[model samples]
Target: MSTTRHELLTAFDLLLAPERFKDYGPNGLQVEGRTTIRKIVSGVTASRALIEAAIHADADAIFVHHGLFWRGQDGRVTGWMRQRLGLLLGDDVNLFAYHLPLDAHPELGNNAQLGLQLGLVAHAGSAGRFGEQEIGFLGAPEDGATFTSGKKLAAHVERVLKRPVTLIEGQRPIKNVAWCTGGAQGYFEAAIAAGADAFITGEISEPQAHYARETGVSFLACGHHATERYGAPAVAAHVAAQLGLAHEFIDIDNPA
Candidate 1:
């Protein structure tokens, strides 16, 4: 089975609605490749390893959450950037990336997927939205379940992600929690304001430790790559099912 690049991009745009987001970079089809795409590869980031793997897999298109270009990066195509782009260009493989849209999507976004994996359920209705662009989510254990304490919650997260989680314990037991995956420590204050007992994100800054201690709100720093590895594959699976195209998820591991 095969689909045109235009069809694939249109499917993604409909699924993510990239225009609704004010993202740091463009959302769809970052690199143009062949007009016809039969097999697609998805990953968390478009690193050199992922590009090589996709090409080696004979993928016609590469779908990812992180792309080559960012808003403030120097516009020069050199160094690692040159090599990555060269590989994609040389093979004529389409590169599609979605940033904030991939984070904010209610059903398939990073936040939603991570929450699902951790067995957390979003608060009913509009209450889940928190932080800038309302990307952060406020939730709790599903089906009236509870974590009892910050340590318990941290353990659960670590178990689910299969990685060590940094925990700054709070004074109180954990009930309601807030989370935004992938370097979203900036949302901690907002999560606190929203009355979360604990806040979970990919990375924690220096100030969050003090804030967690002083404010008595738990903070957990799961790995950035681990938390964000779901959305791209989810989107790709949906697109593949819809378009009758073959899809594979290539995970290029990153410790950070």
Candidate 2:
């Protein structure tokens, strides 16, 4: 069955509540395509490959976490940008993207889903602030379960995410932990303030190493793409199921 673009967007907007966020990009319908959609494709980023893959898959709509437009980018439709836009426009494929909104959702957000993957029970709201938006999550192991040490936590992350985790070890025997899914190493200070024994994020900065050493909060960099693989797919599946459309999640892997 096909659903109108308006029906899909309204359902998603209500579900995600993007109005609550001050996002870097638009939360819905970045590009208009067909008015009705039967097949949808979802991915982490709206890269050229993913767009082309959507085209090949005969997807009427493409939903993603990282959209083409951003806060600081020039508003010109030229160069690589021109090509990407051309594909979407030429194919009449809808492009829907949600950046901070996708990251901030309590259940379907990247951080929350990652927490579930790692067996963490959400204990409190994220201490990390992005303007007024809380983009991270704070958690601990579920009752009667534990991750013995920082090394063990890192190993679990590596096993779950299927990527090599870079560990900056702190004090041993991790108990409380905090995490944000993508390129959020800067939130380590917030994690520390929240009394997290360990912090996990997608990317780490140079200064974060020293912060981890001095503050006794272990840091783990688990690759941005790897960390964010869950949210978009979850959102897509929900949207498709809600709108009675077929949804396929496409993984165009990126090492970064």
Candidate 3:
């Protein structure tokens, strides 16, 4: 039994619901290749580097959080775009990307998976919720586990990122935390309102520095790509087990 690219892509779109949300980049398949997909690979971004990794791994399909053709990028497929897309097309590797849909998927979301990995309790959100406070999540570390200071938590993130995490307000402590994956500095207010003692995100902006100081919310800027790889890879593993497809998750180091 073999899985056609169409069948697998249909299942992914149905599962991730890429059409329902607005995203920065193209959400579904950016390149078409062979009809049959035997090996599936996932990564955080569809960079030329990642594409090379997929090709080296002999993957038939690559699913990612960041895809080509960003909303802000010029529509023309010139320069580096041509080279990158050409690599995928030439190699017969299909690319499937899901951005916001992957971030907000409740159980399979990056934020949720982070909480689970860190052993956070109070898993489910409050029974009744409203408005803007809905997107990010709230959770507490294990009760007996020593509460980590902001510096220590940043160190943990640094270890995960394999580089120093940007630690804002080095003096603060992180007891209750909330975070959203990707470039979501705009959601700082929502995290604060969720009673988060600390907030973690993929990237930070200039004004976010002022906002963090004024709001008295501890903020940590972990690498955006590092924080988002978990959910998509986890989902890929589940897909492999359920459908009996060969799958692997190759992590490409990203600085931003």
- Residue-wise C-alpha lDDT for candidate 2, range 1-256, written one tens digit per residue: 9999998888779888989887777789999999989999999999999999999999999999999998898999998899999999999999999888888788888877888888886674434332235676777787636567779889989999988999999875687788888888888887888778899999999999999899878999999999999999998898899878999999998999
Give per-model CA RMSD: 0.7, 1.8, 2.6
On residues 160-235, what C-alpha lDDT tens digit does candidate 3 reach at each position? Answer: 6576778676344666777776787888777777677777888888877776788766788886887787888877
| TM-score of predicted structure 1 | 0.99
Worst 10 residues of 3 by lDDT: 127-136
Off by over 4 Å in 2: 124-132
**True-structure Cα RMSD, model 1:** 0.7
Candidate 3 local lDDT, residue 203: 89
TM-score between candidate 2 and the true structure: 0.95
TM-score of each: 0.99, 0.95, 0.88
- Model 2, position 163, has a per-residue lDDT of 88
lDDT of 2 at 28: 93
Residues 1-256 of candidate 1 have per-residue lDDT tens digits of 8999999999999999999889899899999999999999999999999999999999999999999889998999899999999999999999999999999999899999999998889997789889898899998888777778899989889889999999999988788999999999999999999999999999989999999999999999998999999989998998999999999999998998
**Candidates' C-alpha lDDT:** 0.93, 0.87, 0.75
The CA root-mean-square deviation of candidate 2, after full C-alpha superposition on the true structure, stands at 1.8
| Best candidate (score: lDDT) | 1
